[model samples]
Target: MQPVRPAERRHETVARLLREEILRGTYRPGERLPIERELSRHFDVSRSVIRQALLILDQQGLVRVRSGVGGGPFVAQDTMPAALAAFENTLAVDPSSVAEFAWAKCILEPAINAVAAETISDEQIAALETNVEASRAALERGESAVDHLIDFHSILVNSTRNRFLAIIVELMSRSMDRLTGTAGIRHLDGAHVLEEHEAIMDALRRRDADEVRALSRDHLTGIWREELGTD
Candidate 1:
């Protein structure tokens, strides 16, 4: 028999190889990988080692394991949440990174908004209008509309119809959420948020890309400046 490697090293090696394969599209997302027995034979390791390696991949959100009649490892359907969680954890360790993120959003979102203005459908505009109206009503009822307001940005990203942009913006939004809880260093007044969103929505409705760009720039600048206490 070949000399046995330590279990830890064996599992880590297996996990690394599987992770690379999944990322390289050898195993597509949501596709099932081979059974533990098959994987063990393929890697020349014990089933326990395969399980341990799978556990590592699961922790990293590369693959998911299921149990029962239809049980085995499968590549993750959506990896963005895992990536965002990792980014949020990193920002948590250095709260100062929040300011850097704010600057990035300030620079990126306005361009995205301009692009969205050029291509956004009428249905999308209606959605933004509805969100803005919801915030307005919530504020009038003396309720906090913070969560609704945060979701406005998400809706805007969706209107862009760019999958990659959606992932990047989602990552930034998650990081911001971590840095600023429900009521943290930069709590946006509901009334102000409504007004800003309304203006941007109007520009989008007109399909006026330039106006949307300017309004979005102003809105993000206000938020980032307040959040970072910068000019």
Candidate 2:
């Protein structure tokens, strides 16, 4: 194998360090990262090297560049959705992928619900209730409840206040719509969804973590079987 050049190694090192700092919250969202010249001096690398490193970060949605005076790289917080969309599009995914995604959701969301059972706030519960109600209303009007269903899941995941999990759920929802389209599974009527959601909500309200986890898993599993005809 060809030897890795010193310049390439330096670039890799810089990228790793910067990414770690961002994940560790040292360089938080909206904070201006050190300027190219400053980072170049600090890392003892060339400005070109710094620019290349920053370019990589920008591509990953870790930072954004602005023009004019005082413009510099600022750590960006909008990475998750964009990253998810990019992944889904790149895969050229289809409906069966949605069933697989639903299986994954069963694993992740239950744990998320367990966490929310312990930590979720009353206000968050209220907001989720509101979403469920709205979903029901849409169903009653004989409208598409797909968006509402996605919104309901989005709200539940966001209630965990875990950015990482939220991103996964966001990506899953996108894939889910594709799966539903391919399977020809129309949205569940509002009443049916409301009853299911109410059960989940009741478990959450009671802080019954086990029930919450079980309900979440069963719910996703049922949806997978019903909509995707998956076992």
Candidate 3:
């Protein structure tokens, strides 16, 4: 891999630190961040680098940029949804990234299922069963099952009770869905997805961690295979 330049590295580091701090609630909504010069001095970088970092944060929807005598960067009021929207608006999430996102689902969902298999409550399993039933009905009615498919996976993620993992999965799933929808990739095989979801639910109900892991991986692989045209 190519090396990162000093200025760019500093800018990215500062931006990541600031973004994490804001996300961790160090800076609340409507609160203005440190001024450009102060931040530059704080990070021992040039003002331009600080400006670049702030611009990155602005693009991520963690902050909003303002101008004039009383304007600067302020923390976003609703960071999560705003960040997702900003990500969608940016040209960054293209076809390639969508494919990669699907692969990430292949990686994460298995572990999520592993955890959910061990810790999920009965109510959670029943809820997933409900989702599976809904998906089956949708498929029977000749409707797209992707929505409930996403919802079923979402419920599985949340069943792990890990906020960080759930949030990451949610963001990636949301972005992938938006990209696929935009690109008109709506020819998902509803019967297959429904069957896999039902099988996954059965695995979860049986508390079979190994089967759940394998099933989740296979399910997500099916999704990305369709996207990557490797099926």
The prediction achieving the highest TM-score against the true structure is: 1
Superposed by TM-score, candidate 1 places the C-alpha of residue 15 at a distance from the truth, in angstroms, of 3.0
Off by over 4 Å in 3: 1-26, 30-57, 65-73, 81-101, 182-185
Off by over 4 Å in 2: 1-8, 20-26, 68-70, 82-98, 159-168, 174-186
Candidate 2 residue-wise lDDT, 112-215, digit = tens:
87888887889989988888888778878878666666666777788887887777776766656554563223544446656777899899889899998998
Q: In model 2, which residue pairs have backbone atoms overlapping below 3 Å?
A: none
Best by lDDT: 1
Q: How accurate is candidate 3 locally (lDDT)?
A: 0.78
Poorest stretch of ten by lDDT in candidate 1 = 177-186
Model 3: how far residue 138 lies from native, Å: 2.6
User: Cα miss at 35, model 2 (Å)?
Assistant: 3.3
Candidate 2: TM-score?
0.71
Model 3 over residues 18-88: C-alpha lDDT tens digits?
98788788889999998888787777788888888888887777888889989988998866887578656
Error of 1 at 18 (Å): 2.6
Relative to the true structure, candidate 3 has a C-alpha RMSD (angstroms) of 6.4
Alpha carbon deviation, residue 111, candidate 1 (Å)? 1.4
Model 1 C-alpha lDDT versus the unseen true structure: 0.83
